[model samples]
Target: MDNFAHLFQGFAIAFTPVNLLTALVGAFMGIVVGAMPGIGSLAGCSLLLPLTFHMDPTAGIIMLAGVYYGNMYGGAFSAILLNIPGDAPAVMTAIDGYAMTKRRKAGKALFAANLASFIGGTIGILILTGLAPTLAALGLKFGPAEMVSLLLLAFTSIGWMMGDDPKYGLISTFLGAMLALIGMDPVNGQIRFTGGNINLYSGLTFIPIVIGMFGFSQVIEMVTNRMSFHFLGGEKLSIKGSLLNREEVKGILPNALRSGVLGCFVGILPGAGATIASFISYMTGKRVSKKGEQFGEGVVEGIACSEAANNAAAAGAFAPLLSLGLPGSGTAAVLLGGLMMWGLQPGPRLFTEQADFCWSLIASMYIGNIICILIAIAVIPFLTKILKVPAGIMAPIIMTLCVVGSYAANNNIFDVYVMIAAGFIGYFLNKNKYPIAPLLLAFVLTGTLEKNFSQAFKINGGSPSIFFTKPISLGLLIFMVLFITVPMVMKKVKASKNTGDQPG
Candidate 1:
């Protein structure tokens, strides 16, 4: 009942005319950002963060949340029309979405994407609203050992689930963890890997690394490959013309809901983000569909599942941040920093002390998602026109944005260098089919993993058994083991069944 009252208060704040207008404006700007190749929610938010300096903190946060969810809707445009994923999470969407477009069902694909995003995002927000307080309370009971084990579980899951080859994922994770270890030692206050470089004192900024890995790297690839934009079957899509048919809606609804739930759960887990959510959703949708054989050939369910999962994952990414002050993804990390910048600290105390702020943010999520849906439907024609722009002209623009985005993060030139380096590394990794998601996951989770592990060790007198001593830790460990083992077992069973079914 108390929670309900708080939510009503939050709705009052979010529903104010000023805040509502900001939400619409944020959604508009977010779509523009997401439509541009290599720019994502984090970059969009960072670029706009300074603009919010003059606003009330609640209003500022509402706008930022609007941008966050709006990007999820806009990301589908490029993926379907140009076969270019505007964000990393949209990669799965492009695989089938573009195919559907090529088959002259571009409108249907786009419609499915938007509809699924709405469903998934709404469910995710509801889950966050209902479960966050409970989760926050649970977080208060966590000692160092539990935290450490949880991070370890995150690492293990990312390594196991992210790539075609687990080894590549593990290696990427190790590299990220090593990079995370560079700056000041957590316990001893000693500098570890600086090697006399002054910039190493504060460690690598998350913005620089993210911009380097996802943003600059994409620009480099476009430049090197001389990639050109190709519209889907030369078709122009309009809002009114893009509604899905009854059959299409019936086919996609189940998968969208299932994937949304799954993605939300995955999003709440440490080190797992939208990329994994989309991938897993795609695979699961394929496995469950009666017409599974038609998945990559432009199936609507594919687009529905992938888009739904990624959007849900975006919503899910907020759970840890709202509940425990631990961000689940790079974008969330940026939001976390923004919170601190605004002199607002996140955690248990946040819910208790700033009930209106927390619930208002949640309330804004509902408003933001609705605004994004409306904006996406209204602007489809304009966004599709972007597909017609020649790559020769677009390439430079994207590169410029990459440079500006990285430099804007800290107003530092070194970040530009980092962006270039990460771009080269990402390009090679992509060429080699090595998953970058694991590296990103590891990079995001490394600090938490290290801090928790160290604290757990200190609390338990360096005893390894401390991890298993707690029921929650033990259960998570067992769950991790099952997560790793079950996939292999299922693969073997399917192979055996296939062999048995073969004609002699």
Candidate 2:
């Protein structure tokens, strides 16, 4: 009853004219950012971090949160119309969405995506409201040993989920972990990898690294290739039917709900984001749907599965951040960093210490999604035409934002150089097919992981078995082992079967 009362109070706060206006503006900006290929929510939020310095913490957080989930809805636009994913999470959406576009059912694709995204976002918010506090209660039981085990689990999960070869994932994680160790030691005041540079003492800036990799690198790639986008036969956008007929809606609702649930669970795990959730949900939908074979060729359920799961995962990624002060994805890490910038530490205490702010933020998500859905539907005609913006015209804009965002992050010229260096290196890494997720995710977790590891050792008086002795830690360790090992085992089995079939 008290919780319900607090929730009502949250609604009161969210419904205020000032807050309502902020939500609308944030949603609009997020949609624009998400629809642009290079400026994902990560870069978008990073670039906008400076804006929060001037506003109330609650209002600032509410706006940023709106941008976070709003991107999920907006990303499907580019995926469907251009076959170019606006962000990593939209990659799966393009598989079916673009196919629908090619077949001239672009309106139906947009309709399916909009409905799925809305359902997923709304359900995810409800689930978060009911489950976050419980998860926070569970997180309270974790000590240093458990935390170390949890980090290990995150590493294993990302490594196994990334691609066909887990080696690339492992390599990416190692590289990130190593980069994370460049700053002063967390336990002691001594710096380990600074190489005598004064700037290194503060460590590599997150904003520059991400801007270089996702923002600058992409623009460089497009310019180098002289990329050009053209619709088939120069066909203009057209849709003949209503947005969603009764039959299509009935066919999609169940799968959208199922994918949302699946995505929420995946999101709760540290580092598993929309990309992984959408792929997993799409595969699951393929296995169960009667029109499974038709999935990649304009199937409505494919759009539902991908869009719903990704949107749900976006909301789900907030759980660990809010409840445990742990980020589940790269964008969440940025948001977590933003929280720190405001002189507010993230963790369970936030719920009690800033109940009004927390609850209002939660309530605003409901409002934001409704706003995002309305805009997404109303702008389909214009949205579909965004692909017409030539790469030549877009390149300079992306480059400018990347540089400006990097400079503003630290107000340092050296960081701009670092961004340029990172961009070139990122391009090289991309050519080699290295997965970037593990690196970014690992970097975000490294400091905390190291801190917990050292603390656990001290608490156990150097007894390593302390990790295995704790029930939760032991279970997490076992899970990590299995997760890392199963892929290798499966590969071996497949190789053996292929060899046996070759000549015998």
Candidate 3:
């Protein structure tokens, strides 16, 4: 009842003229950014984060949240129209969405994506509204040792669960940790790994790295690959043609509902992100649907499951960000930085201290969700036109944005160079099949982990046994170990079974 009352208050705040306009603008820009390939929510938020400095914190964050929600809706546009994913989460959408395009059902795919995104985002926000405060209360019980263990578990999950190979993910995770270690030690206050360079003392700026890796890396790929697209039919993209029939609506409802529920829980997990949620939801749909065999064969269900899950996951990620100061996804990590920059400390205390801000943000999500769907549906005709833009033209525009966004972060020329270097590194890393997500996640979390580990050691007179003595910490450690080991063991068993089946 208290939550409901607070939510009503929040709605009042969100409905204020300035906040509402910000939300609308944010949604529009987010759709444009997400419709462009390679510039995901991470880069989009980073690019626009500088603009937030001029506005009220509430309005600024409202805009970013709008962008986050809008991006989830917009990503499906490119995947359906051009067969290229606008972001990582949309990759699953392309598998089925593009197949629909090939069959001259692009408009239907766009409509299904928009509908599923709305359902999933609504479910996620509802769950988040109910769960975040409870989770924050629960988080208050965690001690330093427990925090350390939990952080370790998050790191382990990122390394062990993401991408095709755990080895590559782990390597990426370690690289991020190594980069994070270059600045002064947080506990000791002693300079380390700076190599006497003045710029290194303050640590690397996150926005530049993020913009380079996600934004500039894509530019590099576009220049090198020079990919082209071909649309099947012009009439198929009309808004009238995009409307779903009764049977189609029924088909999407169950899949979207189920995936929305599943994705929300997945998003709450410390390191499980929208990409993972989408993949898991799509796979679940494949296994459960009656027409499972036709999953990748231009099926509406496939698009619904993938789009719904990713959007749900995007909303669910806020639970940890607000309640525990832990980022639930890559974009959430960027938002975590924004929270700090806004002079608001995230975690359990934030609920009690910043109730107005918290509830208003939640309320705005509902508004943003509605705004995104309406805009997505209304702009469907124009969005298909975006697909006609050539990669050669798009690459230069994104590259210019990347350069400007990076430089604008601190007004530093040096950061521009750093962005370029990171872009090259990211491009090579992707070319080598290494996942960049774990790297960025590790970079974000490593400092927090170190702080908790230091606090635990100080409390226990430098004895590591503090981690084992606490039940929660011990359980978390055990879970991390099992999480890493079980996958390897299963893979080995499967390989052995396959080998045994082959004739000697």
Candidate 4:
């Protein structure tokens, strides 16, 4: 009952003239950014993070969250139109969406994507509204030991995300931790790895590194590779209808709802993000649909599965961050960093201490997603036009943005150089199939992980046994061990199977 009242008040806050305008503008920009290949929500939010410095924190976060959700909606555009996903999460969408486009029902495919996005997004936010508060309330019971264990669980779980090789993920995670250790030690107040450089005291800025990696790295790759695109239909990619028919809607709504639930569940997990959720949903949709055989053949059910699941996952990824100070995904790690920059700490205290801000942010999500659906439909012509914009033009623009964003954060020329260095490192790391997500997220969460670890140790008189003594911390540590070890065991078993099958 109290939560509902708070939500209503949050609606009032979100609808305030300035906040509403900000949401609308951010939503529009986010979609445009996301429609650009390789620039996912992280790139968009990181690039724009500095702009939030001058605004109120609540409004700033609201706008960024809007961008976060809008990107998910926008990613489907290129997937359907150009057979190229704007971001990884949309790769599944491309499977059936592009097929539909090839079948000359691009309009229907576009409509289904947008509709699924709206449904999934709405469900996600609603789930957030319901789950966040409960989790926040429960988080009130946590001690420092539990906090440390929880963060450890988050780190270890997310570390296995590197495709096919968990060791690569672990290496990336350690690098992030090492980077996070570069600044002054929080407990000792002594610089650990600054090498006497004055600029290293405050630590490496998260935004510049993120922008350089996700934004500049891609631009560099494109420019170097001189990437080119060839649209099947050229500049005249046209569609027949903009709105979904009743029968199509009926067929997909149930699946959309099911995917929404699945996506939200996946999102609630520490590192299971949109890509995993979308693939899982697509597979599930294929298994049960009467038109299962036609899934990859332009079926609307396929679009519904992918779009709904990913969008819902995007929304679902917020729960842990808002409630427990633990990020839900790689992008959520960036969002968590942004919150820290604004002097806000995510946790149970956040909801109680800043009810207006948190609730309003949640309220704004509904509005933002509604706006995204409209933009997805009404802007199809304009968006498809964006698909024609070549990589040559885009590369320079994104590179420029990365440079400016890097220099703008602290007005330090050194940061720009740092960004360039990070860009090179990131490019090489990515080229070698190392997962950047664990590194980025590890960097973001490492500071808190250390802080909680130190505090928990002190409280226990420097005895690490407290971690195992407490039930919450013990369970969390056990989970972390399982998460890290199970994958290695599975990989070994698979390798042995393959070796046995090989000829001498």
Candidate 5:
């Protein structure tokens, strides 16, 4: 009852005209930034981080939260329309989303993505509201050893789940780990692979690398392949036609709900971000759905699971941020910096000392979530028009956006060069049919894995027994082992049975 009363007070604060306007503007800008390939929530929020400095801390945070939510909703746009992920989390969405686009179901795909995003965001927020303190406490139990085990499990599962030939996935995984190791060592602060160039000291920036790989590489393919510029059967695009039938809505609800719950849990875990959540949920949907075998061949369930998990993870991330002062993802890290800038110290003290501020931020999320969906739905008709642009015109436009987004990350000319090089590398890799997901997964998790492994070793005085002794770490290791071996064993058993059935 007290919580409800406080929430009502929060609603009162959030209903203010200034706060409402800020949320609207933030959501709009986030959608725009996220829709543009290569400019993800991290870059979008970083660019806008300065704007919040001049406003009230509560209102400012509300706006940034709006952006965070809106970005999750918008990231699917490019993935569905252009077959290029606007951000890392949208990578899984592109597989089926682009398939849907090719089938002239872009409007339906967009609607489903938005609907699932809303459901997931709502679930995450509700969980955060009721269990922020408890979830934070649970997360605090994940020490260095546990984190290392969990990340290893993530890497192994990602590699195993990606491609038909597991070898390709493993190769991509190793390559990503190698690329991640090029920068400075987290434990020793010593550089490893930075040759002679000073720019190499900081290693590579993610934004430039991603823009080059996904965005620029795509531009290369467009020009080289001379692909058709316009989408087929886009003659009568309208809002009414985009509405999901009752059956489609029913199909999305269960997947979205399941993914929402799963995403919240993943989001609470340290270093497991929305990208991983989306991947895991999409894979889970594949295993459970009756049409699992048709996942990448244009399935609404795939979009529902991926988009829901990512958005839910985005909202669930706030639990750790507010209660434990920990950032759940890269974008959350930026938000952490903002929290400090606002003269607020997160943790138990925050809820006690700044209850109004915290509650107001929570209240604003509900409004922002609604505003984002409504805004996104309204813009669908406009966004779908991107499919009608000519190839020649779209090609140059995407290239320019790629360059601008990469340069904007750090205002560095060197990043542009890196982007171009990565583009060529990505193009070559794609030509060879290499699975990119494992490489990306390894690249993101390797650094975190290294840091935790170092920390665990330091804590245990170089004894490897620490990992085995910790209950959580041991459990995760067991799970990882089972996850790897069980499938292979089952495949062998099935193969033997088929061989025995052959006529003599």
Candidate 6:
């Protein structure tokens, strides 16, 4: 009852004319950013952070949250209409979505993506509302050992759940850990791997690394391919025509809901984000679908699973920001910086000290997501026409935007170089069926995992059993073991059954 009262109050605040208008504007801008290749919610939020300085903290947060989810809705437009994904999470969407477009069911695919996003986003918001406080309370009980165990669980989940090869996932994770060790040591105050370079003293900046990995890498790939342009194809979409038939709608709902739930769970974990969510969702949707072999061949279930998970992950990414003063994903990290800039600390203290701001932020998620749905529905037809643009014209524009976006991320040319390098790496990896999600997850989790692990060891006098001593830590370890073990067992069983079915 008290929660309901607080939510009602939050809605009252969020619905104010000024806040509503800010959310609308944020959503509109988010769509534009998401439609553009190489731009993402993190960049969109970062660009808008300075603007928030002039507004009330609550209103500012509302607008920021709107942009976060709105970008997700907008990301689907390009993923479906064109082969390019505007954001990492949308990559899975492009696989089947673009295939569907080529089959002349672009409108149907767009509708499914939109509807799935709406459902996933709404569910995630509701889960956030109901579960955040509980998670915050739990976070208060975390000691160094518990935190370390949790980090281990995150890494294990990411490694086990993503990628075609677990070995490559482990390699990516170790590489990220190495990168995190480049700066001054947290315990000894000694420079570890800076090579006496002044810029290395601060270690690699997150903004530069992310821009290089996602933004620059793409440009290099485009140049190497000598691609003139990428394009989409579809007539102007009609909402009525876009609506899925009974069979199509029914076929995708289960996968969408499942992916939404899975994405939300993953998103709440620090260091796991929409990329992992989408990857896992796509794989799982394929495993469960009756037409699993048709996954990359324009299956509606594929689109639903990927889009639903990514959007839900976007919503779930806020959990750590609100509850623990920890950012779950890159965009959430940027939002954390924005909060600090506003003189508003996140975590449990913020919940009590800035109750209205916190509640209003949550409420605005629901409102903003609904608004994004309406906006996407209204704008998708116009946006879909970009597919018809000749590839010759589109290629150069994409390359230019990719370079500009990478440079803009940190205003550093070094980042552009890094992006190009990462892109070459990504392109080759993609060709070889090496999954990128595990690499990304490894990069994101290494720092926190190492810090917490070292801290926990120091507290426990180097006793590995410390993790098993705490109930929460023990529970998490057990969960991780089960999660990893079960999949292997299932795979073995399936293989055995298949072998048995074959003639001797």
Highest-scoring model, TM-score = 5
lDDT of 5: 0.85
* 189-291: candidate 6 lDDT, tens digit per residue: 7888877876667565443444344444444554566533242333555667777899988878898899888888767766667877877777678666776
> What lDDT, from 0 to 1, does candidate 4 have?
0.77
lDDT-best of 3 and 6:
3
In model 6, the runs with Cα more than 4 Å from the true position are 37-39, 76-109, 139-242, 265-306, 313-358, 482-487, 490-504
Ranking by TM-score: 5, 6, 1, 2, 3, 4
lDDT of 1 by residue, 1-504 (tens): 777788889999999999999988988888778765557777777888888888898888888887887888877887776555666677667767867765666777778888889988988888788887565355455566766665666677666655667787788878878888888877777888989888888777655566566655656666776623343226566766677889988888898899888888767765567766776677667657765557767888888888889888888888788768887777888888888888999876898988888998888888989888888777767665554566666666656766776676667888788778877887788788776656765665687677778878888888878889888788878877886798799989999999999998
In model 4, residue pairs whose N, Cα or C atoms come closer than 3 Å (at least 3 residues apart or on different chains), thus clashing, are none
Better of 4 and 5 by lDDT: 5
Q: How many backbone clashes does candidate 5 have?
A: 0
TM-score (all chains, Cα) for each model: 0.74, 0.69, 0.67, 0.62, 0.93, 0.79
Candidate no. 3 TM-score:
0.67
Could you list the CA RMSD of all candidates, in the order they appear?
5.0, 6.3, 6.6, 8.0, 2.2, 4.4
CA displacement after TM-score superposition, residue 432 of candidate 3 (Å): 3.0
| lDDT (C-alpha) at residue 310 in model 4 | 90
Best-fitting candidate, measured by lDDT?
5
Model 6 has how many clashing residue pairs? 7
Name the regions of candidate 5 deviating beyond 4 angstroms: 227-236
lDDT, residue 95, candidate 4: 68
Model 4 RMSD, rounded to 1 decimal: 8.0
The TM-score measured for candidate 2 stands at 0.69
lDDT values, one for every candidate: 0.76, 0.77, 0.80, 0.77, 0.85, 0.75
Q: Of the pair 1 and 5, which is ahead by lDDT?
A: 5
